[model samples]
Target chain A: MTTTRTPKPATAPKLDPKSRGQGWGHYPLFALAFVGLALFVLPLLGLVVRAPLTKLGALFTTPALLEALRLSLVVSLAAVTLSLILGLPCAWVLARYRFPGRGLVRALLTLPMVLPPVVAGVALLATFGRRGLFGPAIEWLGVDLAFSTTGAVLAATFVAAPFLILSCEAALENVDPRLEAAAATLGASRLRILWTVTLPTIRPSLLAGLSLCWARALGEFGATITFAGNFQGRTQTMPLAVYETLQSDHDGALLLSLILLAVSLTILIALRGELRR
Target chain B: MTLRADLHLTLGEFTLDLAFSAPEGEVLAVVGQNGAGKSTVLAAIAGLIPLQRGEIVLDGHLLERVATGIRLPPQARRVGVLFQGLALFEHLSALDNVAYGLRARGLDKRSARARAHTWLERFGIDELAQRRPRELSGGQAQRVALARALICEPQALLLDEPLVALDAQTRLEVREVLRETLGAFAGVSLLVTHELDDAVALADHLLVLDAGKLAQEGSPEQVIRAPATAHLRAMLSARRTGSTPDPGT
Candidate 1:
């Protein structure tokens, strides 16, 4: 036999009329949102529809394509690693310190994010290239950056590191400094507090920044080509290879573009919640 | 077991210039209006902020001396501060939050967590040790923060509006906990609060701060019997009449 029980009384208040979802006003808003979303979806659909699916296996087997894939992975990963190493301290300083020209310094640091990729490449070359500003100092250290794999990494980092730095700086700024102060009063040193409290508190934003930096570096084309001079098995990343193949082999270019698109879509899907926040 | 501070500093348009001493094993409640530099005194004693020209001595050790240019970092000052926001590390479990200071001082995780478990038990929150700060109720979080602060056995303890975030019932419960804790602790305890009731209830000595300076200091009964400044008079009058004090007055 089943036992009967009384339903609990509703304690929660009713929702306000204005906040109820899907009113007449939503139609126009959704229409515009759909149009904006279609702008992104249509191009991706075109890439998939025009991809060389019949020659997909053959494309995968191609040594040049594989080498470009490997190089892309290497360069982008290096750039991301370098970005984390340099950007974290830069972000902390920018967020915590107050000195003269702080706003200007922040603007200069994040300028690369909005600056044209080719201009960034040119700027990097002017600063690190032979006969450039730091050329003598770099040469004396027996390191050549231009037209090498390292130059490709540097170019990608120069354009992409700002993404990591900007997100992290905003995250660091939002963290209550009182938490760090509390940690200090608990006998934790500055470095210990950073590792334990500060970094853990900003972990989500740090991951988001890492993914953005890696994706930007992976898709970097103009900067790498301008500064590093794309060469097979040397500095030719996937985007550079795709660009060169488009001039001669359209199907090969489509396949390479498909690969990059797939990787970017995966990143966006994985970081959907974090990116939304 | 005494904290003597000569806080002399300027921030923007306001300046904090005061000298106060908190005796061991007793609560000294710092009562003030908003922007009266109540929290500044705690910050200076905790070594979180520098003093332009002052000295802070805790347990006869020089925490800060501007004349000699000797300023110990907060990590070395052996001062525990429970911030107004209760700044518990949200990323860690309650047990880990309580265990933070021990781990910071090089205790092994097992030992620190074991001791933290004991503290949680003492605070009657052993069951909620695995929960995060956000998951716990305000009162539970307060206990966790108190446990964290006291675990290090510091020379001084600072509580900045620790019960201001709690409801009336929870405030009374936590105030009882705080009274018991302060009675047991052998260090100097400075509580910055806005409520006269809490000050009179939990504190042995009452300090009235007005506009970044000390307005009065006496026992709670003494201060209650003789209100010093206009702010104090207004506060006591409001309490007697069961009304809120007027902000303009």
Candidate 2:
């Protein structure tokens, strides 16, 4: 025999009109968003459709393509590492401190992000090339940057460092200054507070910045070719290789293009969790 | 373990000029309405803010003196502060949060965690050691913050509205914990609170501040029996009537 219990009195659940989910009223906005999104994804879709998938295995084994892939990976990773080492302090200074010409310094630092890639390469050459400004002094120390692998890394860094700096600076700005004060009261020194509090607090943004910087460096073309010059197993990255193969071997260029696209998509997907947080 | 502060600071249209002292083993409650420079006074004592003039001395050490241009940084002053929001490190576990001071003072990781664990146990929060700050309830967070402040054995402690963020029930519970802890502490403690009940319950001496100046300073009983300023008189009457006092009045 089942026991019977009295039902408890209940009131109607409140429904907030403002909190309601999407309905017919949201359809126009949703359509516009989809259209805006399609503008970004359509080119990739086109590339995927035209790519020679059947010969992908054979294309991957091409010596020049393999060399370009390896060099691109090495140079881009180096560029990202360089960006972190140099850009983090710059970002920290910009975010936390105020001094003379701060606005001018920030604008100058971010100049390369919007400057044409070719112009950045020109600037790099003018600063570090054999006959360029400071070039003679640099060569005196037995260092050659222009038309070398080092030049490729430098060019990529010139274009990508600003992305990391901007993201990291914004992240630092978002952290509560009171937290640092708390750390100070806890007997933490300036560097200690940065390591345990400030840096950890902004870890997600740092990761986001790293991925963006790496991806930007991976896709660097105009700057690399202009300053470093495309040379197999040396300065030629995937983008430069793809550019060269476009004239002689369309299939090879398509394969290289697909590889670059795949790499960027994978990195973005991996960083989605960090970016969302 | 004594704190002597005479601060004169100017921020825009507002200027703070106040002087007070708290000897060892005493809790001096700095009571004031909002924007009355209560927090600013604490910040100056903690070395977070600079004084335009005047001096702050802790146990004969010159922490700050604008005349001599001698001001020590916060870390070197050995002051522990509990902010209004607690300001517990969100990234760290409860144990690590308590251990932060020990680690910052150059203690090894193993020993710091061990010591931190002991402080957690002292606060009856050993079970929550591995949990992050956001995971703990308000009272638990307060206990953890208190433990963190006491762990370093600071020369002076600064508490900013420690019980203001808690619920009614939790406030009573945490107050008991704080009363016991403060009673045991040998160092000077400066408690900043807006609630008159909190001041009466915790502080040995009371200081009523109005418009960046000291309006009244005495024992809790003396302040209630002989209210000096209009603000204090209003507050006493509001308390007697079981109603919250209007800060503006």
Candidate 3:
């Protein structure tokens, strides 16, 4: 009763082993690949290979360290929540609709992700800085964004939202709109279709995106520093804290980096489990 | 339960101008070659595709003239479509998929699940309610789709080749279930297909579309005996491949 017949023929693209006179080119490329993978992986292995086993106790007990870690979690989690609330719809628009300036909007969103994090910091400072366009109006309301915890969240969100937006959009794009159409024919309105049919179908992508956005926000440093000036226990997140520790407490900095990496990896694995078919 | 449509639409390289009616409880099979506008007719009627001119009336409601146009969105139309792929949500269980329409209509989760269970039971797929689309056999998927669509109690059902994806062995069984389901439907049904066997199995009225135009519309025996056009005669030939004069040429 199984459908064992008519297996699909896969077209695997390959180069013939016997025909090459490109040994010189092949060797360099092979060597480079070996070096590249090692370069990519060696540092991560080095973290475990060279840990300050004895000083780990002090690193965890520091009040400043705990506060920074707490701030990092709060800001990054908020950033991810906001990203889902906002970016999911934005992703839908980018994925499903065609309009003028769509390509431009997509590219600009990538700016925070691709540009040097420090340069993104400068960009954010210019836009939301005290003397920036919205700064005067913002200050007049007795609300100070610069050098504040909210500033860290805003800064993280600026860079992190793009990750969720792109990932969720791609997931939404892959969902067959036919299913949504099918739902519509069943007496549902557009909004109803989105909430009930469309959202469930694209849930994995949204989850994946938020996880990535949270990871990105957690690792955010330059934008947080520039937009919200690092102040320990106030705006200094784990990354900012790590930067401060780098000068005087190298072991502590490494410990914080390791924790961040471990947490992000766990999140990614959990997210993948959620998204799997 | 009756459905009426007068539609004209232009999509990229093709145009569709169709006027048709399916009385309550009748199953109308739309037979056409590729790009013959059969799918376009369904999309237009479902309000998925924009129409340059036309209106659709479903069970006495002027569906085409609302602010959104006689083309109320696919959701508001309450017309069920068994898309060619069956397009089940890959992530959801069969029960959840069947409950999709009820939820979209804003039913409470409890009521939706109950209705979905009723639908699955009717389709005889209740045992497979927890299975995802990928886990179901082709016939099972089709049944799930049918159940999902029927649960809404749509005024009309539009099926786009419900059996095309099935292997030969499975298609016969699925076709039989589809036959029974169509017979049981209290509303109008329209099945779009290129296969004569499929059209004949579930539909009483047949439409032959050639190049975005309706070449002929009648019962299957009538079409088989006296095809309206030579192109249609060639199409009617059992072989999947055959040549016909281009309608434009």
Best model per TM-score: 1
The interface RMSD for candidate 3 is: 2.9
lDDT of 3 by residue, B1-249 (tens): 789987777888888877889899999998887778888888887888877887889999877853355456676787888898887887789999898878767799899999899888888879999998888888788889899888888898899978775676677788789889999999999999987667876788998888888889898778877888765677567333555222111
Candidate 1: regions farther than 4 A off = A1-33, B243-249
i-RMS for every candidate: 10.4, 11.8, 2.9
Per-residue lDDT over B1-249 for candidate 2, one digit per residue giving the tens place of the 0 to 100 score: 888989999988778999988899999999888888899999999999999999999998999999999999999998889888888889999999999999999999999999999998888889999999888877888888998988999988889988885765677777888888888889998999988788888999999988899989999888877877776677677777876432212
Which of candidates 1 and 3 reaches a greater lDDT? Answer: 1
For model 3 the local lDDT of residue B241 reads: 57
Give the C-alpha lDDT of model 3. 0.82
Name the candidate, 1 or 2, with the larger DockQ value.
2
Off by over 4 Å in 2: A1-21, A24-35, B243-249
When summed lDDT is taken over every stretch of 10 residues in candidate 2 chain B, the lowest stretch is: B240-249
Residue B36: error of model 3 in Å? 0.6
Per-model TM-score versus the true fold: 0.92, 0.91, 0.89
Q: How well is candidate 2 docked (DockQ)?
A: 0.37
Off by over 4 Å in 3: A1-30, A272-277, B65-71, B239-249
Question: What is the C-alpha local distance difference test score of each model?
Answer: 0.89, 0.89, 0.82
Which tens-of-lDDT digit does each residue in B45-156 have in candidate 1? 8888899998999899999999999999999988889899799999999999999999999999999999999999999999999998888877788889999999999888
lDDT of 2 by residue, A249-272 (tens): 888788789999989989989889
Fnat for each model: 0.60, 0.55, 0.59
